[model samples]
Target: MSEDLPIRKIIHVDMDAFYASVEQMDNPDLKGKPIAVGGGGKRGVVNAASYEARKFGVKSAMAGNLAAKLCPGLIFVRPNFERYTEISKKIRAIFYEYTDLVEPLSLDEAYLDVTNNKKGNPSASLIAKDIRERIFNEIGLTASAGISINKFIAKVASDYNKPNGQKTVNPEEVTNFLEQLDIRKFYGVGKVTAEKMYQKGIFTGLDLKQKSLEYLDENFGKSGRYYYHIVRGVQNSEVKPNRIRKSLAAERTFSENLSSEIFMLEKLERIADEVSKRLAKSKVAGKTVTLKIKYSDFSLQTRSKTLPYYMSDKSIILETAKDLLYQETLNNSVRLLGISMSNLNTEANKKIEEKSVSVQLKFEF
Candidate 1:
């Protein structure tokens, strides 16, 4: 939409095997070993598996038993979410140092719009290199970055050189790169859609780009517009800062089903800490706090309470969540616990003065 302005510079940064890497970083002995950071018991799932484990056919979301069968000597450890959150915070602080137009996709990835950055770097590739180096030196983690004129190209470029690497796609190379890409590798083309495309002889970006808009729309519906633009290197998406949250939740699946109140309480404290940190980072406060419990049978029940005022403090959030949990009746052992904060201050008077100052600056600009 803002294409009339100077061609925008966007970067996507993704950490390689974030959870597995963090686990390996914490325990030096786990380095170069087939380690997974989830599931050590029956009915457990793998959250993340190291690259070494991946060589033996291990992957995230695979059943722990299946992963063990794939790699007989695989080591599994419970996730340390608190440590991961701490590291994410440190990395995000570094991103803000360069630009306020940072949009975090998750704890391990983000899109940065550096069109007019605080550091005044003209080249997005150099900024990406600096960010990746800073992350490695300061946070002890490997990050891969992609720099391009738009989000689509930037996302594709970032994956080209992964694990402490960076890649850039200039405007001139955009069309040629897309032409050779496999149809399946195009972003947003899932397995089912890719199979359909293959059956229709649309095996490459070149083939897709040749199809008329009406034809693509007939087959792919609303997403056809997206495909048309991306195939032609015409992405116009913006990197929006301070994106509002629809719902904020933190959850953990235990290594074993826990019926003990003490063990569950300890886990709740950690989850509360994570939720509080996210709330603080986003500068949001919620009036409602909900506690969710999933039983061993996979059935879930939730209980929530709304306070008169918004809360961002860790202790207050935990106390409120604990009270909600106490009020609910548990019929079975819980395999997972979740805490969500919602009903945000979407319209509060805190921004009135700020908006007035911004309006004045707009006229001056």
Candidate 2:
């Protein structure tokens, strides 16, 4: 596998605290405060929490009520999707300015393969630095970047210097770097998996590398193969640019089935807010809004509205979704309600410019 691998240059760019950062960027008054974005009501859930809130044990996906309890004076705000979508588009545009081999993980993170970049910059470190500066100057948001010969090392490098910073992992230093890294820090190793590794006395990349591939496979199942390769600084994942997006949706499974018109409408408002936020972050407007309902009896139904104009507005999206929901008769109590936006705009493309390669770093292997 190593014999066929290309000497590639990969950069992983991740925006620090994406949703929370957007909120702070939009409103200066909220800066440096413990802020959470999501539900403010009795059944509210946190969609995003700022770094300040993180210090107080607040986190995304946690119940908003619980989050408020964890941090005194925690401020909660509903999400704004349209604005986030606009900012995401601007950031993506900046990425295309460097190389077209860009693979977006989400609105705020992506991987770029610049091994044969259009700009012909020999030093991947310099390219990452340039990208970081441009994002701060143009988008008014800070981003962290990592540059390396492969994605695994690059991702770790990016996190080393975060919140408006950049770093590089040269090929020669890869071994020493991985040797000292905690086992939990290895990609694809999550909390449960890390705990299992710790039980087996696998606490660092060096320890993982010492295990035979067959032995790892017997214990970790399919993931053990991935661990074996990454510990050896081998990653084959490609920077797949222009990957098609699927499954654009928003949904809410109510705590209880509801028949009240006013209550249903309020829930639709919150769902629309979430759907819009994601749409804006992707910089794509949707032509279809699908409303889904699951009855208490485990029966399901869906209604959709196709708009003449693509939209990312919260009001327009919610109104359309509500209209679709209202079109159906509420003969049975609805237990789950969902709204999804699809048929996104795909006009964006990456562009790489031309330049001379200045220097090449030789690998000792």
The Cα error of candidate 1 at residue 90, in Å, is 1.0
lDDT of 2 by residue, 322-341 (tens): 78877857768887788887
Q: Count the backbone clashes (under 3 Å) in each candidate.
A: 0, 5
Q: TM-score of each candidate?
A: 0.72, 0.71
lDDT of each: 0.85, 0.82
Off by over 4 Å in 1: 1-3, 249-365
State the lDDT of candidate 1 residue by residue for 1-365, as single tens digits.
33234457889999988999999999999999998888856777998888899999999999899999999899998999898889999999999999999999888999998888899888788899899999999988999999877777788888888767988877767778889889987889999999999988999999999999999999999999778877887666678686657568899888789986767889999999999998988888999999999899989999999999998888999999899888856879999999999988864443322110000001000
Q: State the displacement of the C-alpha of residue 74, model 2, in Å, after optimal TM-score superposition.
A: 1.4
Instruction: Give the range of the ten consecutive residues with the poorest summed lDDT in model 1.
Output: 356-365
What pairs collide in candidate 2?
81-276, 81-277, 85-280, 85-281, 118-353
What is the TM-score of candidate 1? 0.72
What is residue 181's positional error in candidate 1, in angstroms? 1.6
> Candidate 1 at 292: error in angstroms?
11
Off by more than 4 A, model 2: 1-4, 244-249, 255-365
